[model samples]
Target: MTGTAGDVIRIAKSQVGYHEGYSGGHWTNLQKYSPAVPGLEWSQNQAWCATFAAWCFQEAGMPKGSYPVTASCALGVSWWENAGRFSDYPGIGAQVFFGSGGGSHTGLVYAYDADFIYTAEGNTNSSGSAEGDGVYLKKRARRDTYVYGYGYPSYPTGIVTADPAWKNPTAPSQQEEAVALTDDDIKKIGRQVVTGANGAKSPDDPTVEWAMSSFLGLTYKTARTIAADVAAVKAKVESLSVGGVDLDALAEKVADKLAARLAE
Candidate 1:
Protein backbone atom coordinates (compact mmCIF):
# COMPACT_ATOMS: atom_id res chain seq x y z
CA MET A 1 0.00 0.00 0.00
CA THR A 2 1.10 3.57 -0.61
CA GLY A 3 2.22 5.34 2.54
CA THR A 4 1.35 8.79 3.80
CA ALA A 5 3.26 11.69 5.35
CA GLY A 6 2.39 10.26 8.74
CA ASP A 7 4.01 6.96 7.83
CA VAL A 8 7.26 8.67 6.85
CA ILE A 9 7.29 10.54 10.14
CA ARG A 10 6.57 7.36 12.11
CA ILE A 11 9.37 5.44 10.42
CA ALA A 12 11.84 8.27 11.04
CA LYS A 13 10.72 8.55 14.64
CA SER A 14 11.37 4.82 15.10
CA GLN A 15 15.05 5.34 14.28
CA VAL A 16 15.71 8.06 16.84
CA GLY A 17 18.64 6.41 18.65
CA TYR A 18 20.42 4.65 15.78
CA HIS A 19 24.22 5.16 15.79
CA GLU A 20 26.97 4.26 13.36
CA GLY A 21 29.14 1.23 14.04
CA TYR A 22 32.96 1.25 14.10
CA SER A 23 34.75 -1.02 11.61
CA GLY A 24 38.03 -1.14 9.57
CA GLY A 25 39.72 1.43 11.84
CA HIS A 26 37.07 4.02 11.05
CA TRP A 27 33.53 5.09 11.82
CA THR A 28 32.01 2.85 9.13
CA ASN A 29 28.45 3.97 8.37
CA LEU A 30 27.50 0.32 8.30
CA GLN A 31 23.82 1.14 8.44
CA LYS A 32 20.76 -0.39 6.81
CA TYR A 33 20.05 2.78 4.77
CA SER A 34 23.17 3.03 2.56
CA PRO A 35 22.55 -0.13 0.55
CA ALA A 36 18.85 0.65 0.16
CA VAL A 37 19.63 3.48 -2.28
CA PRO A 38 21.60 2.80 -5.46
CA GLY A 39 25.03 4.54 -5.74
CA LEU A 40 24.96 5.50 -2.04
CA GLU A 41 27.18 2.72 -0.59
CA TRP A 42 30.21 4.94 -1.29
CA SER A 43 28.77 7.45 1.19
CA GLN A 44 29.14 5.01 4.08
CA ASN A 45 30.93 6.75 6.97
CA GLN A 46 30.42 10.13 5.26
CA ALA A 47 27.80 12.69 6.27
CA TRP A 48 24.49 10.80 6.06
CA CYS A 49 21.83 13.38 6.91
CA ALA A 50 20.42 13.25 3.37
CA THR A 51 20.73 9.44 3.28
CA PHE A 52 18.57 9.20 6.40
CA ALA A 53 15.85 11.33 4.78
CA ALA A 54 16.01 9.14 1.65
CA TRP A 55 15.65 5.98 3.74
CA CYS A 56 12.61 7.31 5.56
CA PHE A 57 10.91 8.08 2.22
CA GLN A 58 11.90 4.68 0.78
CA GLU A 59 10.71 2.68 3.79
CA ALA A 60 7.47 4.64 3.85
CA GLY A 61 6.68 3.12 0.39
CA MET A 62 7.34 6.25 -1.66
CA PRO A 63 8.22 5.04 -5.15
CA LYS A 64 11.77 5.83 -6.37
CA GLY A 65 10.86 8.63 -8.81
CA SER A 66 8.39 10.23 -6.42
CA TYR A 67 11.05 11.23 -3.92
CA PRO A 68 14.73 12.05 -4.09
CA VAL A 69 17.25 9.34 -3.12
CA THR A 70 20.71 10.78 -2.65
CA ALA A 71 23.53 11.25 -0.15
CA SER A 72 24.24 14.90 -0.98
CA CYS A 73 21.91 17.50 0.51
CA ALA A 74 22.65 19.89 -2.39
CA LEU A 75 21.72 17.26 -4.96
CA GLY A 76 18.51 16.51 -3.10
CA VAL A 77 17.57 20.21 -3.12
CA SER A 78 18.34 20.38 -6.83
CA TRP A 79 16.18 17.34 -7.49
CA TRP A 80 13.15 18.90 -5.81
CA GLU A 81 13.78 22.30 -7.40
CA ASN A 82 14.05 20.79 -10.86
CA ALA A 83 10.75 18.99 -10.36
CA GLY A 84 9.12 22.25 -9.14
CA ARG A 85 8.43 20.69 -5.75
CA PHE A 86 10.73 22.89 -3.67
CA SER A 87 9.16 25.30 -1.21
CA ASP A 88 10.20 27.90 1.33
CA TYR A 89 7.47 26.88 3.78
CA PRO A 90 7.52 23.74 5.87
CA GLY A 91 5.20 20.76 5.33
CA ILE A 92 4.74 17.54 7.27
CA GLY A 93 7.11 14.78 6.04
CA ALA A 94 8.98 17.19 3.75
CA GLN A 95 12.75 16.82 3.42
CA VAL A 96 14.29 19.79 5.25
CA PHE A 97 17.62 21.08 3.99
CA PHE A 98 20.01 23.15 6.07
CA GLY A 99 23.30 25.10 5.95
CA SER A 100 24.80 27.10 3.06
CA GLY A 101 22.63 26.80 -0.07
CA GLY A 102 20.95 23.77 1.59
CA GLY A 103 23.97 21.55 1.12
CA SER A 104 25.46 20.97 4.56
CA HIS A 105 22.72 18.87 6.19
CA THR A 106 19.26 17.42 5.70
CA GLY A 107 16.40 15.89 7.74
CA LEU A 108 12.71 15.07 7.70
CA VAL A 109 10.26 17.64 9.02
CA TYR A 110 7.71 16.02 11.33
CA ALA A 111 6.05 19.18 12.66
CA TYR A 112 6.22 22.93 12.55
CA ASP A 113 4.67 25.91 14.27
CA ALA A 114 4.83 29.60 13.56
CA ASP A 115 8.11 29.94 15.42
CA PHE A 116 9.85 26.57 15.17
CA ILE A 117 10.25 23.48 13.00
CA TYR A 118 10.81 20.02 14.45
CA THR A 119 12.86 17.36 12.67
CA ALA A 120 14.17 13.78 12.76
CA GLU A 121 17.77 13.84 11.57
CA GLY A 122 20.63 11.38 11.42
CA ASN A 123 24.34 12.21 12.06
CA THR A 124 23.49 14.86 14.63
CA ASN A 125 23.89 15.38 18.37
CA SER A 126 22.86 17.85 21.12
CA SER A 127 24.90 20.57 19.38
CA GLY A 128 23.07 19.93 16.09
CA SER A 129 26.30 19.64 14.08
CA ALA A 130 26.04 18.74 10.39
CA GLU A 131 28.30 15.74 10.91
CA GLY A 132 27.57 14.38 14.35
CA ASP A 133 26.61 10.94 15.66
CA GLY A 134 23.16 9.13 15.59
CA VAL A 135 19.58 9.79 14.69
CA TYR A 136 18.00 12.52 16.84
CA LEU A 137 14.93 14.70 16.88
CA LYS A 138 15.74 18.40 16.99
CA LYS A 139 13.86 21.64 17.13
CA ARG A 140 15.13 24.70 15.29
CA ALA A 141 13.84 28.20 14.80
CA ARG A 142 11.78 28.72 11.67
CA ARG A 143 13.97 31.65 10.61
CA ASP A 144 17.28 30.05 11.55
CA THR A 145 20.06 31.00 9.18
CA TYR A 146 21.03 27.37 8.65
CA VAL A 147 17.48 26.44 7.66
CA TYR A 148 17.24 26.85 3.87
CA GLY A 149 13.94 25.39 2.62
CA TYR A 150 11.90 22.22 2.00
CA GLY A 151 11.66 19.49 -0.66
CA TYR A 152 8.07 18.23 -0.95
CA PRO A 153 7.47 14.66 -2.11
CA SER A 154 4.64 13.84 -4.48
CA TYR A 155 2.92 11.24 -2.32
CA PRO A 156 0.49 8.90 -4.07
CA THR A 157 -2.36 10.24 -1.98
CA GLY A 158 -1.68 13.98 -2.36
CA ILE A 159 0.55 16.86 -1.28
CA VAL A 160 -0.36 19.73 1.01
CA THR A 161 1.97 22.68 0.70
CA ALA A 162 1.89 26.32 1.78
CA ASP A 163 2.61 27.57 -1.74
CA PRO A 164 -0.61 29.00 -3.19
CA ALA A 165 0.52 28.56 -6.80
CA TRP A 166 0.75 24.80 -6.31
CA LYS A 167 -2.62 23.11 -6.69
CA ASN A 168 -3.87 19.97 -4.95
CA PRO A 169 -2.09 16.99 -6.53
CA THR A 170 -5.20 14.84 -6.80
CA ALA A 171 -7.66 17.44 -8.03
CA PRO A 172 -9.90 16.59 -11.01
CA SER A 173 -8.44 17.00 -14.49
CA GLN A 174 -9.16 19.78 -17.01
CA GLN A 175 -11.45 17.45 -18.97
CA GLU A 176 -13.70 17.14 -15.93
CA GLU A 177 -13.75 20.92 -15.53
CA ALA A 178 -14.77 21.33 -19.18
CA VAL A 179 -18.08 19.54 -18.51
CA ALA A 180 -19.05 21.76 -15.56
CA LEU A 181 -22.13 23.71 -16.62
CA THR A 182 -23.41 27.06 -15.39
CA ASP A 183 -27.15 27.81 -14.89
CA ASP A 184 -27.33 29.75 -18.18
CA ASP A 185 -25.52 26.98 -19.99
CA ILE A 186 -27.83 24.38 -18.51
CA LYS A 187 -30.91 26.34 -19.70
CA LYS A 188 -29.46 26.48 -23.22
CA ILE A 189 -28.87 22.72 -23.01
CA GLY A 190 -32.50 22.22 -21.92
CA ARG A 191 -33.66 23.95 -25.15
CA GLN A 192 -31.51 21.53 -27.14
CA VAL A 193 -32.99 18.60 -25.24
CA VAL A 194 -36.57 19.76 -25.95
CA THR A 195 -35.78 20.36 -29.66
CA GLY A 196 -33.94 17.01 -30.05
CA ALA A 197 -30.84 18.94 -31.17
CA ASN A 198 -28.84 17.00 -28.55
CA GLY A 199 -29.07 13.82 -30.67
CA ALA A 200 -31.86 12.06 -28.71
CA LYS A 201 -31.87 9.22 -31.28
CA SER A 202 -28.14 8.60 -30.93
CA PRO A 203 -25.90 7.96 -27.92
CA ASP A 204 -25.97 11.08 -25.72
CA ASP A 205 -22.83 12.84 -24.56
CA PRO A 206 -22.05 11.32 -21.14
CA THR A 207 -21.13 14.67 -19.67
CA VAL A 208 -24.32 16.34 -20.96
CA GLU A 209 -26.36 13.37 -19.77
CA TRP A 210 -24.78 13.52 -16.33
CA ALA A 211 -25.44 17.25 -16.08
CA MET A 212 -29.11 16.76 -17.00
CA SER A 213 -29.63 13.71 -14.79
CA SER A 214 -27.56 14.71 -11.78
CA PHE A 215 -27.86 18.51 -11.68
CA LEU A 216 -31.31 19.06 -13.22
CA GLY A 217 -32.73 15.82 -11.76
CA LEU A 218 -34.08 14.83 -15.18
CA THR A 219 -34.85 11.28 -16.28
CA TYR A 220 -35.35 9.93 -19.83
CA LYS A 221 -39.14 9.84 -19.49
CA THR A 222 -39.29 13.35 -17.97
CA ALA A 223 -37.21 14.74 -20.90
CA ARG A 224 -39.52 13.05 -23.49
CA THR A 225 -42.61 14.55 -21.79
CA ILE A 226 -40.98 18.03 -21.82
CA ALA A 227 -40.30 17.59 -25.56
CA ALA A 228 -43.94 16.66 -26.22
CA ASP A 229 -45.21 19.66 -24.26
CA VAL A 230 -42.94 22.03 -26.21
CA ALA A 231 -44.04 20.57 -29.57
CA ALA A 232 -47.73 20.99 -28.64
CA VAL A 233 -47.19 24.60 -27.49
CA LYS A 234 -45.23 25.45 -30.68
CA ALA A 235 -48.02 23.97 -32.86
CA LYS A 236 -50.69 25.99 -31.04
CA VAL A 237 -48.58 29.20 -31.24
CA GLU A 238 -48.06 28.69 -35.03
CA SER A 239 -51.82 28.66 -35.64
CA LEU A 240 -52.41 31.86 -33.57
CA SER A 241 -50.29 34.35 -35.59
CA VAL A 242 -51.45 37.98 -34.99
CA GLY A 243 -51.20 40.54 -37.84
CA GLY A 244 -47.80 40.22 -39.66
CA VAL A 245 -45.72 39.10 -36.61
CA ASP A 246 -43.87 35.74 -37.00
CA LEU A 247 -45.61 33.60 -34.34
CA ASP A 248 -43.21 30.68 -34.77
CA ALA A 249 -40.18 32.86 -33.94
CA LEU A 250 -42.09 34.50 -31.07
CA ALA A 251 -43.01 31.07 -29.65
CA GLU A 252 -39.40 29.80 -29.85
CA LYS A 253 -38.14 32.90 -28.01
CA VAL A 254 -40.85 32.51 -25.34
CA ALA A 255 -39.92 28.81 -24.90
CA ASP A 256 -36.27 29.74 -24.46
CA LYS A 257 -37.17 32.38 -21.84
CA LEU A 258 -39.39 29.88 -19.97
CA ALA A 259 -36.69 27.20 -20.08
CA ALA A 260 -34.20 29.66 -18.54
CA ARG A 261 -36.63 30.44 -15.70
CA LEU A 262 -37.44 26.76 -15.09
CA ALA A 263 -33.74 25.88 -14.86
CA GLU A 264 -33.43 28.34 -11.99
Candidate 2:
Protein backbone atom coordinates (compact mmCIF):
# COMPACT_ATOMS: atom_id res chain seq x y z
CA MET A 1 0.00 0.00 0.00
CA THR A 2 1.07 3.53 -0.62
CA GLY A 3 2.26 5.60 2.28
CA THR A 4 -0.12 8.09 3.89
CA ALA A 5 0.22 11.26 5.94
CA GLY A 6 -0.74 9.25 8.97
CA ASP A 7 2.09 6.86 8.31
CA VAL A 8 4.65 9.65 8.21
CA ILE A 9 3.21 11.27 11.31
CA ARG A 10 3.18 8.00 13.22
CA ILE A 11 6.81 7.30 12.38
CA ALA A 12 7.85 10.83 13.38
CA LYS A 13 5.98 10.68 16.67
CA SER A 14 7.63 7.42 17.51
CA GLN A 15 11.02 9.11 17.42
CA VAL A 16 10.07 12.05 19.60
CA GLY A 17 12.62 11.55 22.33
CA TYR A 18 15.50 10.38 20.15
CA HIS A 19 18.57 12.61 20.58
CA GLU A 20 21.99 13.11 19.10
CA GLY A 21 25.20 11.53 20.39
CA TYR A 22 26.60 13.02 23.64
CA SER A 23 29.94 14.20 22.24
CA GLY A 24 30.01 13.31 18.56
CA GLY A 25 29.41 16.74 17.04
CA HIS A 26 25.73 16.48 16.12
CA TRP A 27 25.88 12.77 15.22
CA THR A 28 22.49 11.11 15.23
CA ASN A 29 20.71 7.83 14.56
CA LEU A 30 19.58 9.44 11.30
CA GLN A 31 23.19 9.87 10.26
CA LYS A 32 23.92 6.26 11.13
CA TYR A 33 21.01 5.20 8.95
CA SER A 34 21.50 7.74 6.15
CA PRO A 35 23.73 5.43 4.08
CA ALA A 36 20.77 3.09 3.65
CA VAL A 37 19.26 5.63 1.29
CA PRO A 38 21.51 6.78 -1.52
CA GLY A 39 22.21 10.55 -1.79
CA LEU A 40 21.11 10.92 1.84
CA GLU A 41 24.51 9.90 3.22
CA TRP A 42 25.92 13.42 3.62
CA SER A 43 23.67 14.39 6.56
CA GLN A 44 25.87 12.67 9.16
CA ASN A 45 26.74 15.37 11.69
CA GLN A 46 25.22 18.50 10.19
CA ALA A 47 21.77 19.95 10.99
CA TRP A 48 19.24 17.14 10.57
CA CYS A 49 15.75 18.61 10.77
CA ALA A 50 15.19 18.16 7.06
CA THR A 51 17.07 14.88 7.14
CA PHE A 52 14.76 13.58 9.83
CA ALA A 53 11.69 14.62 7.85
CA ALA A 54 13.07 12.91 4.76
CA TRP A 55 13.77 9.77 6.76
CA CYS A 56 10.25 9.66 8.17
CA PHE A 57 8.86 9.85 4.65
CA GLN A 58 11.25 7.14 3.56
CA GLU A 59 10.30 4.84 6.44
CA ALA A 60 6.64 5.47 5.73
CA GLY A 61 7.23 4.25 2.16
CA MET A 62 6.78 7.58 0.44
CA PRO A 63 8.43 7.71 -2.96
CA LYS A 64 11.74 9.52 -3.29
CA GLY A 65 11.61 13.04 -4.79
CA SER A 66 7.99 13.40 -3.62
CA TYR A 67 9.55 15.33 -0.74
CA PRO A 68 12.85 17.21 -0.79
CA VAL A 69 15.75 15.26 0.62
CA THR A 70 18.13 17.90 1.88
CA ALA A 71 19.54 19.25 5.13
CA SER A 72 18.68 22.81 4.17
CA CYS A 73 15.23 24.04 5.19
CA ALA A 74 15.28 26.72 2.51
CA LEU A 75 15.76 24.10 -0.21
CA GLY A 76 12.80 22.17 1.14
CA VAL A 77 10.66 25.31 0.90
CA SER A 78 11.82 25.94 -2.66
CA TRP A 79 11.03 22.36 -3.68
CA TRP A 80 7.45 22.56 -2.50
CA GLU A 81 6.92 26.08 -3.86
CA ASN A 82 8.24 25.11 -7.26
CA ALA A 83 5.98 22.06 -7.25
CA GLY A 84 2.99 24.26 -6.28
CA ARG A 85 2.68 22.32 -3.04
CA PHE A 86 3.47 25.17 -0.69
CA SER A 87 0.72 26.76 1.44
CA ASP A 88 0.30 29.35 4.15
CA TYR A 89 -1.95 27.03 6.08
CA PRO A 90 -0.74 24.06 8.04
CA GLY A 91 -1.82 20.51 7.24
CA ILE A 92 -1.08 17.26 8.95
CA GLY A 93 2.31 15.94 7.83
CA ALA A 94 3.16 19.25 6.20
CA GLN A 95 6.73 20.46 6.68
CA VAL A 96 6.74 23.73 8.64
CA PHE A 97 9.52 26.21 7.89
CA PHE A 98 11.01 28.75 10.29
CA GLY A 99 13.47 31.65 10.64
CA SER A 100 14.52 34.29 8.14
CA GLY A 101 13.73 33.33 4.57
CA GLY A 102 12.50 30.03 5.99
CA GLY A 103 16.05 28.75 5.97
CA SER A 104 16.69 28.27 9.67
CA HIS A 105 14.73 25.22 10.82
CA THR A 106 12.12 22.72 9.71
CA GLY A 107 9.58 20.39 11.28
CA LEU A 108 6.56 18.26 10.45
CA VAL A 109 3.20 19.70 11.45
CA TYR A 110 1.09 17.20 13.34
CA ALA A 111 -1.75 19.53 14.27
CA TYR A 112 -2.81 23.17 14.43
CA ASP A 113 -5.47 25.31 16.02
CA ALA A 114 -6.51 28.91 15.58
CA ASP A 115 -3.71 30.17 17.78
CA PHE A 116 -0.98 27.52 17.73
CA ILE A 117 0.71 24.82 15.68
CA TYR A 118 2.08 21.53 17.00
CA THR A 119 5.11 20.01 15.35
CA ALA A 120 7.37 16.98 15.43
CA GLU A 121 10.81 18.43 14.78
CA GLY A 122 14.26 16.94 14.85
CA ASN A 123 17.42 18.87 15.79
CA THR A 124 15.38 21.01 18.20
CA ASN A 125 15.21 21.33 21.95
CA SER A 126 12.58 22.24 24.57
CA SER A 127 12.88 25.93 23.69
CA GLY A 128 12.12 24.98 20.03
CA SER A 129 15.14 26.72 18.50
CA ALA A 130 15.90 25.62 14.96
CA GLU A 131 19.44 24.62 15.87
CA GLY A 132 19.38 22.33 18.86
CA ASP A 133 19.81 18.73 19.86
CA GLY A 134 17.28 15.87 19.62
CA VAL A 135 13.79 15.23 18.33
CA TYR A 136 10.98 17.06 20.07
CA LEU A 137 7.27 17.72 19.83
CA LYS A 138 6.85 21.51 19.86
CA LYS A 139 3.90 23.82 20.33
CA ARG A 140 4.37 27.18 18.65
CA ALA A 141 2.37 30.32 18.20
CA ARG A 142 0.92 30.43 14.72
CA ARG A 143 1.68 34.14 14.36
CA ASP A 144 5.35 33.69 15.23
CA THR A 145 7.48 35.64 12.76
CA TYR A 146 9.84 32.68 12.57
CA VAL A 147 7.06 30.57 11.08
CA TYR A 148 7.42 31.29 7.37
CA GLY A 149 5.01 28.74 5.88
CA TYR A 150 4.32 25.07 5.15
CA GLY A 151 5.45 22.55 2.51
CA TYR A 152 2.93 19.91 1.52
CA PRO A 153 3.64 16.32 0.55
CA SER A 154 1.70 14.81 -2.32
CA TYR A 155 0.13 12.04 -0.32
CA PRO A 156 -1.82 9.35 -2.17
CA THR A 157 -4.97 10.30 -0.29
CA GLY A 158 -4.50 13.98 -1.20
CA ILE A 159 -3.60 17.06 0.82
CA VAL A 160 -5.99 19.22 2.83
CA THR A 161 -5.31 22.93 3.26
CA ALA A 162 -6.99 26.17 4.29
CA ASP A 163 -5.95 27.77 1.00
CA PRO A 164 -9.11 28.02 -1.08
CA ALA A 165 -7.23 27.16 -4.23
CA TRP A 166 -5.91 23.87 -2.92
CA LYS A 167 -9.17 22.01 -2.37
CA ASN A 168 -9.31 18.94 -0.20
CA PRO A 169 -9.62 15.98 -2.56
CA THR A 170 -11.70 14.06 -0.05
CA ALA A 171 -14.40 16.73 0.14
CA PRO A 172 -14.93 18.25 -3.25
CA SER A 173 -18.55 19.28 -3.00
CA GLN A 174 -18.09 21.05 0.29
CA GLN A 175 -15.53 23.40 -1.20
CA GLU A 176 -16.51 26.40 -3.26
CA GLU A 177 -15.19 26.71 -6.79
CA ALA A 178 -13.21 29.91 -6.59
CA VAL A 179 -10.04 31.39 -8.00
CA ALA A 180 -6.97 30.32 -6.07
CA LEU A 181 -5.46 33.14 -4.04
CA THR A 182 -1.70 33.41 -4.04
CA ASP A 183 0.05 33.78 -0.71
CA ASP A 184 0.58 37.43 -1.54
CA ASP A 185 -3.08 37.94 -2.30
CA ILE A 186 -4.19 36.51 1.01
CA LYS A 187 -1.66 38.52 3.00
CA LYS A 188 -2.42 41.69 1.11
CA ILE A 189 -6.14 41.34 1.53
CA GLY A 190 -5.83 40.51 5.20
CA ARG A 191 -3.72 43.58 5.88
CA GLN A 192 -5.88 45.88 3.79
CA VAL A 193 -9.12 44.89 5.48
CA VAL A 194 -7.74 44.92 9.01
CA THR A 195 -5.89 48.19 8.62
CA GLY A 196 -8.61 49.90 6.64
CA ALA A 197 -11.15 49.15 9.31
CA ASN A 198 -11.81 52.14 11.60
CA GLY A 199 -9.62 54.28 9.34
CA ALA A 200 -6.07 53.00 9.71
CA LYS A 201 -6.82 51.31 13.01
CA SER A 202 -7.72 47.72 13.81
CA PRO A 203 -10.94 47.03 15.62
CA ASP A 204 -9.94 46.07 19.16
CA ASP A 205 -12.94 43.91 19.94
CA PRO A 206 -11.97 40.27 20.34
CA THR A 207 -14.99 39.25 18.33
CA VAL A 208 -13.96 41.39 15.37
CA GLU A 209 -10.34 40.21 15.56
CA TRP A 210 -11.45 36.59 15.76
CA ALA A 211 -13.78 36.96 12.81
CA MET A 212 -11.11 38.60 10.65
CA SER A 213 -8.52 36.01 11.66
CA SER A 214 -10.86 33.12 10.82
CA PHE A 215 -11.91 34.63 7.52
CA LEU A 216 -8.33 35.16 6.42
CA GLY A 217 -6.87 32.01 7.99
CA LEU A 218 -4.46 34.34 9.74
CA THR A 219 -3.54 33.99 13.37
CA TYR A 220 -5.32 36.20 15.91
CA LYS A 221 -2.02 37.74 16.84
CA THR A 222 -1.34 38.65 13.26
CA ALA A 223 -4.73 40.25 12.90
CA ARG A 224 -4.18 42.25 16.06
CA THR A 225 -0.69 43.28 15.11
CA ILE A 226 -1.75 44.42 11.69
CA ALA A 227 -4.20 46.78 13.33
CA ALA A 228 -1.95 47.88 16.15
CA ASP A 229 -3.73 51.22 16.47
CA VAL A 230 -7.05 49.67 17.45
CA ALA A 231 -6.86 50.59 21.12
CA ALA A 232 -6.16 54.28 20.36
CA VAL A 233 -9.27 54.54 18.20
CA LYS A 234 -11.59 52.34 20.23
CA ALA A 235 -12.61 55.01 22.76
CA LYS A 236 -13.15 57.57 20.03
CA VAL A 237 -15.52 55.29 18.12
CA GLU A 238 -17.38 54.22 21.26
CA SER A 239 -17.94 57.79 22.50
CA LEU A 240 -19.25 59.19 19.23
CA SER A 241 -23.01 59.59 18.90
CA VAL A 242 -24.56 61.24 15.89
CA GLY A 243 -28.37 61.57 15.57
CA GLY A 244 -28.96 58.60 17.87
CA VAL A 245 -27.02 56.23 15.62
CA ASP A 246 -26.56 52.76 17.13
CA LEU A 247 -22.83 51.98 17.51
CA ASP A 248 -23.54 48.23 17.41
CA ALA A 249 -25.31 48.71 14.09
CA LEU A 250 -22.36 50.76 12.88
CA ALA A 251 -20.00 47.95 13.81
CA GLU A 252 -22.14 45.55 11.79
CA LYS A 253 -21.90 47.89 8.85
CA VAL A 254 -18.12 47.89 9.22
CA ALA A 255 -18.15 44.12 9.16
CA ASP A 256 -20.22 44.20 5.98
CA LYS A 257 -17.71 46.55 4.43
CA LEU A 258 -14.90 44.16 5.38
CA ALA A 259 -16.69 41.27 3.68
CA ALA A 260 -17.26 43.36 0.59
CA ARG A 261 -13.60 44.24 0.47
CA LEU A 262 -12.64 40.62 0.87
CA ALA A 263 -14.92 39.60 -1.98
CA GLU A 264 -13.37 42.18 -4.27
Candidate 2 wrongly placed segments (more than 4 Å): 24-33, 169-264
Q: List the residue pairs that clash in candidate 2.
A: none
Candidate 1 stretches with Cα past 4 Å from truth are 22-28, 172-192, 195-264
lDDT of 2: 0.79
Question: How would you encode candidate 2's per-residue C-alpha lDDT over 1-264 as one tens digit per residue?
Answer: 267999999988999888777655644444443564568787777788888888888889999779888878899999999998898888888999998878999999888888899999988899987777788999999888989999989898786555567765464443455658899797667666765663555445455566676766655655675465455446556677655768898778767765664565
Model 2 weakest 10-residue run by lDDT: 24-33
lDDT at residue 119 of model 1 (Cα atoms)? 93
| The best candidate in terms of lDDT | 1
Q: Each model's C-alpha lDDT? A: 0.81, 0.79
- What is the lDDT, from 0 to 100, of the residue 17 in candidate 2? 84
Candidate 1, position 143, lDDT: 92
